[model samples]
Target: MSDESAENLIAVGVHVIVKKHNFSKVYKVSENGTLMLGKNQKVEMHEVVGKPFWSTFEMIPKRGPSKNTYSLRLVERTESLNDLSGLKGQLSGQDNRLIVDYGTSQGLSKDEILRLQEAGKSGKEIIGSLIENSTSFAAKTEYSQEKYIRKKERKYMRFLTVCRPTIVSLHEMYFRQYHEKIGGLRMDALAQILCYSDVQADGLHLLYDSGCQGLPAAAMLNRIGENTSGHLINLHPGNVPQTAIVQAMNFPQELRDRHVAVNIYSFLRLHYQGESSMLDNISTSSKKVTDHIVERSVEKLNGETKSDEVSRTDTDISELETDAGENSTLFLRDAEKDADTLKRKLHEFEEAEEAVPVKKPKWFLETQRALDLLNSSKVRGLTVIAKEHPLNIVNALLPFLGASRPFVIFHTYREPLQETFMELKQKRNAINMRLFTNFLRSYQVLPDRTHPDILMSDTGGYILTGYLVQE
Candidate 1:
């Protein structure tokens, strides 16, 4: 491959677009891995690893491990049907009167097709053979013949295109199949949110994403670019933020670090009050949930072997590190051992050694850093895309946004944004507030047959956008 082609090679572990016909999906390319496309059909990832994006590959039937079974191997397609227009020359009737609905239109049987597959017949070759054997081939019109060939090709002519995953491709995939997972957020709506919020490189932005599989954050990060001063605080409602799309984007570690995913509860408390306030809440929650917790006490025997002592020591260190954030004090586990024993030892150790440093939890440290950023008042914009009511969330986060900056709120339903519009208007908290929805229609432009697609989504959800002002 040339240097240009090498630049577009599909790398392993990054998401790749697998497309066939009108349906498309995203899959992580892995070494020596295969993806199942249809019943008894599969495509190997190794075939596309060094291939450029949008390269088409044909699935060739191969012999499986068991006798008389066939599998598929993806091979780079070197041939193209550039003269498909010539197919019109061989037609007779103008409509489907000549075409029969019987299953025996083609001469080949299932066993013969399997035999052809086992005989190493390419998809194109097999499709050609089927066309040759079809009794209705020359009886139908050119359009009918083309439609018949296409329908057959989709089934017998197994081919797929390898595409590089992008925001548009990934979002389309999610919107088509997993609409509920992304809060029914359409691409146009997401684009509007980014544009309305003015998410660009080299500024601090805030996102309160209650859901959408991290798509809102990923879009903002993509716009923010790499090696820039831009930073984003992605505040999610859950303890573990859903960042599948973010990871799928395969961004560099530097760009990924610029995005801080913190829990909304911890961030707000830490920013407005202090770390102690969040810690107190955490401690209370942990206490309430510790009732069914079983505490395992590790005891070292006097006659323990050297290997056993080393293993137990490692276990102790791991547990201590894991539990350090929950209970700040280091405990002498050898002398004291019980569930409540940990609590008692923690109190005694804290009383005796007040100068000792305690390790903060990972979430706590992240919340601290985000809190610092919030306190600096550098956040230029705020975006809220949530499954819950956006009113309360917008009200809580609007105060942190910089004056005269933009904020965009997105909800699947318009009524919630309508209520938010009313609430913000009453409070006089924002100006230029616009609550609106988007309609996205796709078109299929072909030679002499251009028209809009047969089906389209009636609503792409609603967005409420505005500029914030200091009271």
Candidate 2:
């Protein structure tokens, strides 16, 4: 059920669409589910559960049918096609020994048609009877006959199909259904991300997304592989995480645990300052407490924990000190305060690491744990897709990554990306800078009668991709 390409099989908690004749509606599959169509037509979950998606079934007739008591006829959509031809060709004139004056053919009477339709006959049988009853039946062209059959089949068809939701299927669904909520990201753009990023199973991906309710993350998760789990680091703004895309993806339980969400605020605290900055601050400060923090950091990383105290801390004091140095006044008391007050503040800072999280999420972790991850990371790539300009963010994040780490940024417009490209081009830390926009059009594939769709999406935003090469 977790596989992105795994379709046909119906499962609970997945999105499905019930299609009957010309009417269709999408639904989340669940047990004992019932859907009322038009005024009287209804669907039951038991009729669809364990059935292959896209397979059509018919409503079984019963006396004074109650909603719950109705049964289904597994009318295999292709059951009559057991004798299908092995070859294909255009419907030529006179091939079926039939020609018709489409303008002059008088259709059967309504009463007569109703009597035939209510005789409990199959769609095929009903169509056959109507064709035979037509006054011009023997004079219609083969193509005309096929055209007539299709038109009537749609009106009289009583079968419904359960459509499977694949990436393409889901994309169409989202693009058409909730275009604005999912950041208005076109399907082609989504496909482009999966290819350009080159993210795969077992690879570590760091992503900052503030668009379309976490849809980019979910897309990457799906591309990484349905059966093989992938590690994803989701970076988002504010305290509450936006993983709407993850919800839409509907990953299985085992795979859902693989996603780790870290707020941008927490990520910046540790990533903004390096060890060298901390050491410089330590040399300048007269506080011996900074040295103690450095020692504990080494000890903690080396697995030399002597008690539960150090282990419980959210982050080491030295970790905080790195962020504190830039805005030292924020953490430090006024100059008028005595030395003891400053030392007491240091202890309180140290104790904060161990304090239970109040508003932070514990599923992946709080800010302190994110700070720890900041120092211990070997992630290979970064992907940014946000409503805000990502230029300011890319510059700050480049130095934290190892050499030759690729990063891609997506935006609907090119101006922000152009600015970032210029900055990276001058710094020399990023190479292979290129601006990209996909020109995509789909063709309708049919023998001797195919052409590009009458209309297509003209644009799918811009992409900037490059690698960080430390000087």
Candidate 3:
């Protein structure tokens, strides 16, 4: 393979899409591993290595010598979908009055279907055979026939398409299978959070997120851009912030460093008590070590110079005692000046000693960095997406945001945001507050059959957006 081809080829540890039945999922390609789709459904992932993104492969079932045992082999780097466009040319009845529902509509039995699968018939061929064997397929309406074909395709087809993972694609996968994991945050809702909060490059944003798996923080970081100096301080309830989705983003180390994940407890504790309160112990110990070193150096310098000064002072005293006149008074004044100069020089020497740099822990450094921004009220925006009461979290973190900066709160329930909205209004801490939800409906576009999808999410959760006002 050429160098260019190797660069484009899929490698381990990078996220890739595993698509089946028009639904897609994001999975990191691992070496010599298998991807589990469900309890009994999985695909051997080794074949996807070195395959280019967006390439498609067919899964062929090879029968074992033992009864009822088989393994799948992926072959044919061809692109295809479960398209019923060929059936588009076929006639359709106006209604399904003539159609009858029966379990025996498909003429192929389980054993025959297994045999056909073992014969290495491709997914498309198997779907076509199933469609041909269905006695009632022709009698169904166009929409019904299309639905039937899709249903059969899902069961028989094993086409895997590898796609380059994106933020939006991964968000959709989380929303579908693990909605609660992301705190029921929808893609549209997340987009609104970004827009309302005005997340952009070179902006300092603060976020308190839990149950979202770090998706909100990741989205903000992506918007902040990789090459900019924007920073995100993510506060989570857990001891360690959730970073699964963030890792999936595959952000560069420089961009990842811009994000500071800290525990909410520690952050709030430091914030309320001041930095000095927490660092006092560390500082006291550090100061003790530094003072001990400085004191020893000063004592050694004094011992070397003080003995000679004392001997000179004794000899001068003996000579001055014999004189007892203006010369002695003059000598006393000179001695006072010399003593002052020595004290000044000793202080200077102590100040000149190079102190060893104290290396702080990573968490302490990150927390302190975030604290500096918060204490200065430099955060341009604040977003709260938590499973807990948004009221308490928002009330505690809202003051850290700069004046006129935007703030958004997301919750799975409307009541929490409503309550928060009322409280913010009562306190007059925010203006232009709007509590609303989004209704998203997907569509299935086809010739003379374009309509809203029969199934849709009723609500994408609620969001309360407003701008903070200085008190």
lDDT by candidate, in order shown: 0.77, 0.66, 0.78
Pick the lDDT winner: 3
Model 3 over residues 159-244: C-alpha lDDT tens digits? 77777767798888888878778877888889999999989898689999887877998899889987897989999898778988
lDDT score, candidate 2, position 345: 72
Model 2 ranges with Cα > 4 A deviation: 1-26, 36-41, 52-55, 60-71, 79-121, 125-152, 175-188, 213-215, 226-229, 237-250, 262-372, 396-400
- lDDT string, candidate 1, 4-81, tens digits: 766588877778778877678778888888787655555556767766678887665555674422333446554344
What's the TM-score of every candidate structure?
0.80, 0.61, 0.74
Write down the worst ten-residue block by lDDT for model 2. Answer: 81-90
- Model 2 agreement with the true structure over 171-280: per-residue lDDT tens digits: 66566656666666788777767676668896677788875766788788887765674677788887778775566556777777667787876567545664444444
Error of 1 at 202 (Å): 1.4
Report the Cα RMSD per candidate: 9.7, 17.0, 16.8
TM-score (C-alpha, index-matched) for candidate 2: 0.61
